[model samples]
Structures are given as structure tokens and as C-alpha cells.
Target: MCNQTTTAEKSSPTHIYFDSPEKHCRGTDYLCCSISDIISEAKSLFNLAFPIALTGLILYSRSIVSMLFLGYLGDIELAAGSLAIAFANITGYSVLSGLALGMDPLCSQAFGAQRHKLLSLTLHRYVVFLLFTSIFISFLWINMFNIMVYLQQDHNITRIGQRYLLFSLLDLFTNSFVHPIRIYLRAQGITRPVALASFFGTFLHLPISFVLVSHFNFGVSGVAASASISNFFVLISLVAYIWVSGIHEPTWEKPSFECLTGWKSLLKLAVPSCVLVCLEWWWYEIMIVMCGLLVNPKALVASMGILIQTTSLLYVFPSSLGFAVSTRVGNELGANRPYKARLSVAVAMFISAIMGLSALTFATALRDKWALMFTSDTQILRLTSVALPILGLCELGNCPQTVGCGVLRGSARPSTAANVNLGAFYLVGMPVAVGSVFYIGIGFSGLWLGLLSAQVCCAGLMLYVVESTDWEQQAKRARMLTCIDIRQPDDFDCNKGEVEQPLTCSA
Candidate 1:
């Protein structure tokens, strides 16, 4: 039989930390759930936040450095590494990662409910689901390099990109395994496992990068090799953590179909969540291609690359808050307290916005120093300095938007997010952005304008959605908070219930 498991047939695999799902209680005094506990939770959240941000910095910085290091091997390798990363991140990594983010909210709700019964069942089947996705995505990378060449990237670039893709594809394990493993740990209120794991991964990255690039003469392959090595170690670290904690197979006497049913619930939020990410990543891939066609194109691409990357690095903090908020909100909703979910989201968004402002201030203060830390090109620095402040403003919009998406995710309503992103990025944001860049002749500032505009639109929609969220409805929706699908058929016999609905979806 083909290994595709349907909602009915899929069973949740058992793990060590899974508390029985049957014991979940409804109608608790969610307000009385201790302000001290909340503060302590927030404090623990802060501890995880910066570490996650550092991990992002280390991961992205390694890629930046690895590319520069491989450049010493030759321009072909350098160009190839860049091309491969763009292609896979767009089509494979970013595409697959949506499902990973999807896992966090579901796990959070489960953790909040303290329902171990459904724990292993949901995560177990999710692993199976992601394994299928990982396999397909891996094959796509292996098979699609030639198509990328046909897409008209330079020949030398294609060859180098292909070699890097071969190495980069190894993260199917990290993308598929590590994200869920870490998120599930977080759901258990255990931040240390992922914190320690990411640190371990980063620590492992340094020596492997040096040895492969400098010592072994592996060149670009060496950088890719280091990534593969680092990921393997990270995976091993997480698995070991889970194992020692007694959460995996050793304690499992059997599996439950309840968890399998839960996977569908998770998808109700996951699919739309993935679409939101795909839409965002897909557009940037286009922007990168278009930007590469401009005057002083390498500088344009490199300059924007530096700033775009810097935003992603700084993004780790708010992104962590978003994750924390999603978990908190989902847990609250699952426990039948929609109002607290609202308040918690407000608090998290405020905190994230403060963090965003600090990042912006830091970036602005150091804008002239780009020549030192982020890059060395005099022209690129000048270009980036002109652009960094706008990018700093871009952070202002991006901050709440990340948390907003997280809020929507907790409600099992990723479709609202998908449409919001679609409108903000594609309809409202990109047109004016590209036109501004090429037409107004402001160069890349137009692109930044477009991105900033999109971020604002997205933030506005997110705020509106959160404001309008009926916690009671979300509480009910939390019952299905495990699958990746988001579509629902409303009862409307021949279309005249006089109840006009807004766009409905649940990725």
C-alpha cells in the first residue's frame, strides 16, 4: 500500500511527554492563572528570545560568511552558492518551513490544555506528514537544478548553485525534524532544550566551517559540508534531549488514532500558514531576480542582500515573541478564555514593538559602520547607509506583523493571514514598489518602500483581525487545532442566509 495516511487512518505516534488528552478541562478561571506565573513565563520567554535571535544570526551569518569564504575558491562557486540558496529557499526551504511554524501553535494549545493524551498522537503523525513533505522537497532540489539553469541564471552560477543545493538539501532533516522537536519542547514549557540545541548547533557550525573551508580545501563544498554536519549534530542533540527525557519510543506501548485525527486539525491552521510564507518568499525571489538586472547590479543585489539579511537577523527577536504569543494565546483559547488571549497578544505585540524600535535604533546608529561588521564595499556601504534607515522603518511595520500572524495562527485562522499577506505584498505593496524602484528612479529605495508599505498593510490587517477575533469562536475552533487545512463549508442553502461572511479560512 502507498504510505499516504488519511485523516481517519492516521494514528498519533506515542512519545514520552504526551499527557493523556482526555483530561483536558474546560472553563477555568483563566484570569486567576497567576500574574506571577505570567511574569515568570514572560521572563523565561525573554531568555529564549535572544538565544533564538542569536541562532538566527549565527545561521544567517554563516551563510553570508560561507559565501564570502567560498568566493576565494572562485566566482563560479560564489555565484553558484548564491543561486542555489535563493532557489531552494524559495521553492524548498521556505515552502516547507510554513508547516514547521504551523506545528508551534498546535503544540502550544496542546501544552496549555495539559493534554498529554493527544501529544504523541499529534506530533507522531505530524512527523510522518512532514517526512513525506521533506522527501518530496528533497527530490525537488535534486531534480530541479537543470530547470534552474533553464530559468536563465548564469552557467557558472548554476553549476555552483547545484553543488550547494546538494549540500543544502540535507536540511530536510533539520527543517522537518528539528522545528517540531523544538516547538514541542517549548509547548512543554521547556525552553532550555531548544535553546541548548541551537547553541550546540551554532557552536558546532564554527569549527566545521573553519575546518572544511580552510583546512580541507573543500571550498564552497566545505561550507555546505559544515551546514550538513551542523544540522546532523543539531538533530542528534534534540533527539537525545527527547530520548533522555523519556519521550520517544522507549515508553510507548502503542499509538492512538486520536492524534492522527488531530493532524487534520493542525492543518486547518498549517496550510494557510504555509501559503502566507510561500507568498512572501515567492515575491522576494522575484524581487531578487529583478534587482539583479539593474545598473551596478552586483552592488544592488549585494547591498540589498545585506540589508534584507540584517532585517531577517533582527527579526529573530520579534519572531520569537510571535511564537511565544501564539503558544500563549492558543493555550488560553483552548482553555476557553478568549479575552485573555486578546490581552496576551496585546502585551506580546507591545514588547515586540519595543524590541523592533531598539533594533531600528541600533541599525540607524551603526548605519555608517556597515563597512565594518556587515560588509566592506565602500559603494555598498554608501548605498546601504542611504537605504538602512528606510529598512529601519521597515522593521517598525514588520514587528507587529510577525506577532499578528502568530495571533491568527493561534485562532486556527491562517487564511485570514494568507489573504492579508496576499493583499499587502502583492496587490498593494509590490506594484507601487517595483514602479517606484524602476520608474521613479530612486533605485532600491522603491523596493524598500514597497516592502515597508506591505509590512504596514499586513500590520493593519493583523491588528484588525485580532481586534475582531471572537475568542468564543476561537475557543471552539481550538478543538480542531492540529491539522494543516483551513477550509470550512458554511451552511447556506442555495446562498441566502442573509449572513454575509468575511473571507473564511484556517491555515
Candidate 2:
């Protein structure tokens, strides 16, 4: 007989974290029910979040290192390199990273369900899909010079930007491979290896950029080349660790033709995931590009770059928590533990709120001083100070919204998050931003305020969606989706029976 277990059966937990509530609580007090429960959730979140945040910080420092090297070259080189990096992020890097996120739901759910072979196949498929996607993105980079020219950017800056992008093209292929490997490991809660690899890679980057640009006189191209080379180093190190460590041995399967079979489901999630990320990432890039068309374009563009970098630096905390919660929530749901999944979301939001407040205080307090790290120009510094407070305020909403989106992804609801982003950023934020910058004449400060508005809107929408979510249904969906072959009777039946052995909760 086919194995059968209903949602009602899975909803009843053998072990309860809270004393009073047998049923899942939608109230805020749910998280505060027991001190021990809160402590356990915090420990689990911190363990996962710390390494991811550190890895993000280490990786982000590579760009900062490159920018510092270029700054020594000249203001023009600094401005041009920044522009090229922003453009690359919008056109290439962000898209690739977002698309690769398709693996999050699949791999995390598969690992949670103990479907080891399914995890291996999904990883292989993403590798293949991302590599093909990189080729098209590479074509865009090759033609970026012309695209910049058509946009009527400065001739000298355009030339320098093109040179930087030419060398940076190598990262396209390297990252295509590296990102999936990183995500595959992350799905299994193995974040320290990637963090270690990023630390070593970034530690090498400073000297590499110094030698290539200053010692060899390769100019801006050297900065770009060093960044790409550092990524390759990280990739090599991660691959070596994965093989030698044997930690992921059970999930490692020989490459097979069956890996090609999941394009439809993967793309269904990937396209929306891409849209979800790109909508948010590309907004900042668009603001940077728009700044280039303003009066005092160079100074404004440079100031915007500093602001973007600073915000990105602070963003590591919330983004890390988002990734952590996604894994935690998805794992619980896959294991058919709806109560635990809801608890993870509550804990993640609480953590993000505290982090957001801390970020706001830091950004506001250092508004005057933060820009000094990047540039000394009085105008650029003044503009950045004006924007920093707004950027900090924006984080209050942005951080929680980020975690909220992660909850949606874990629940197999990327499309819902995508729709919220579309309406919030485009329908509401973009118009306000354009009017503020051009018609209202408030400049970069106005641009940030618009973003803050969008964040507020997104946060409200996501909170509602997550609050209203049917955890039992989400758990059912996760089980169905993670099955090796949901269409097959034996595999489908096997998955239903698999959930009978309740998943053990661990940090």
C-alpha cells in the first residue's frame, strides 16, 4: 500500500517548545513563551548567521580593496572603476547571484528531507543552468562599452570602465561555478568553510591589487584582474575542502543525465527569485546611474558610490539573517515540522529588528565620518553625510523585509515576494525618487528617502504575507517538492512515509 500521512498528523508535535500553546500561535507572544525556547532559537540563528555574515563581509571587502587601489591611481580611475563595478553588478553579478538562489529551496528542502541524491542532482542542474546563463551575461559585458557610450557617459570614464570590465569577465565563469558550490554547502548548514575560504581570498586580495596595479602598472584593469583572481582562489579552496573534508559525502552523487530533468521547476523558482533580488539590487544601481546624469555628475556619482558601499557593508547582518532563516524555515518545513518553521520566522524577525536598530544608530552617528574612508572632497563628503542618515533609516524597514522575503522563499513562495517588490519599488518608489531628484531638486537625499518609502511598503506587505501563511500547507508543499520524483508513485509514497519519523530539531 502507498504510504499515507495527512497534514493534520504532521502538525501534532511529539515535543513542544512552549507549554501553553499546543496549536501554533499567531501572536507576538509566541516567541516569548519560554526563555529556553528563545535561547535555543537565538543560538541556532547565531550559529548560522555569523559565518554567512563573515563570509559576506570578506567577499565584499574584495571590491573595497579594488576601489582603494584604483583611488591611488587617480580620482578619474576611482570614479570610472566604481561606475564599471556598479554596472557589472546590475547587468551581470546581481542577476547571476539571484538566479543561483533557485538552489536555496531545492537543496535546503532536499537536505532536510534526507533525500541526499536529490540534493546532488539539484546542485548539478544549477551548475549547468548558471554556466549557460553566464555566457549570455558575458555577451552583455563585451558590449558594455557601447552601451555606456549610447547612454552618453564621459568618454574617458567610459574607456576606463570598459577596460576594467574586460578583465573582470573571467569572474563570470568562476562565480558561475563557485556560487552554486557555496549555496550547496550552505543548504547543509556548512557555512564556515566558505567563510574561511573568503577570508583567505580577501586577505590575498589587498596585496594582489597592490602588486598588479602599483607594482606592474596595469592600471584599472589590474584592480579588476585582482578581484577576479581572488574569486578563483576562493573557488579552488572551497572545491578542495568539499572533497577532502568528506562532510558532504552522503549528498555527493556521480553526475548523471537525470540532472537535466528539472529545468521547468527550477526556472519556475529561479526566474521569480531573480526578479525578487534584481528588483531590490537594481534599484540602487539605477539610482547610481541616474546620478551620473545630474549636475556635478562626477562628485555626485562618487558620493553615491561611497553611500552604496557603506550601505552594502551594513547590509551583511540582515542579509545573513535572511539566508539563515530561509535555511531554518525550509529545513523544518521539509521535515514536516510546521510549528518549528513558524518559530524560526518569529525568532528571525526579532533578531533582524534588533540588528536594524543597531545599524540605524551606527549609520546616524557616523554619518559625518563614514565618507572620510572613501574620499576627502568636501562636496562628496557633504553629500554622503546627508544620505547616510536616510540610508540608516531605510535599514529599519529593509532589514526586516529582507528576512521576510527569505521566509517566503523557504515556503516556496518566491513569486509572492517578487510581486510585492515590483509594486513597492516600481509603482511607489521609482516615481517618488525621480521626482525628488529632478523635479523637487532635493538631490541624492531625496533619492534615498524614496528608497526608504519603498522599504516601508515592502516590509508591511511581507509581514502580512508571512503572518497569514498556512504553515501546515507550506510543510506539505515542501515535502512534495523535495521528493526525488514527485510524479512517481513509489517516490511520492516513500516521502509520505518518510515524514512519519519526526525530524529532530537542531541548531
| TM per candidate | 0.81, 0.91
Off by over 4 Å in 2: 1-33, 484-507
Instruction: Judge candidate 1 at residue 226 and give its lDDT.
Output: 86
Residue pairs with clashing backbones, model 2: none
Per-residue accuracy of model 1 over 1-507 as CA lDDT, tens digit each = 001112333233321112232321122211222446447556755664655666666666656666566545654454456556667878787766787666665666765655554455556656667777888888778865677666655555566667777877678766677766666666665666666666688687878888888898777778887887887787888778877987554213245554445455557556887897888777666665566567765566556556656776778778878777777787777665665675576567768678878878978887888634544667777987887888788778888888888788777677888999999999988987888987888777788788888888888887777766566557656644432113344553222223322111122
Candidate 1 stretches with Cα past 4 Å from truth are 1-51, 54-61, 64-68, 71-79, 143-145, 247-266, 480-507
Model 2 over residues 367-457: C-alpha lDDT tens digits?
Answer: 9998887777899889998888999999999899999988888777888999999999999999999999889999878899899999899
Model 2 residue 234 CA deviation in Å = 0.2
Best by lDDT: 2
| 214: Cα error in model 2, Å | 0.7
By TM-score, who's the top model here?
Answer: 2
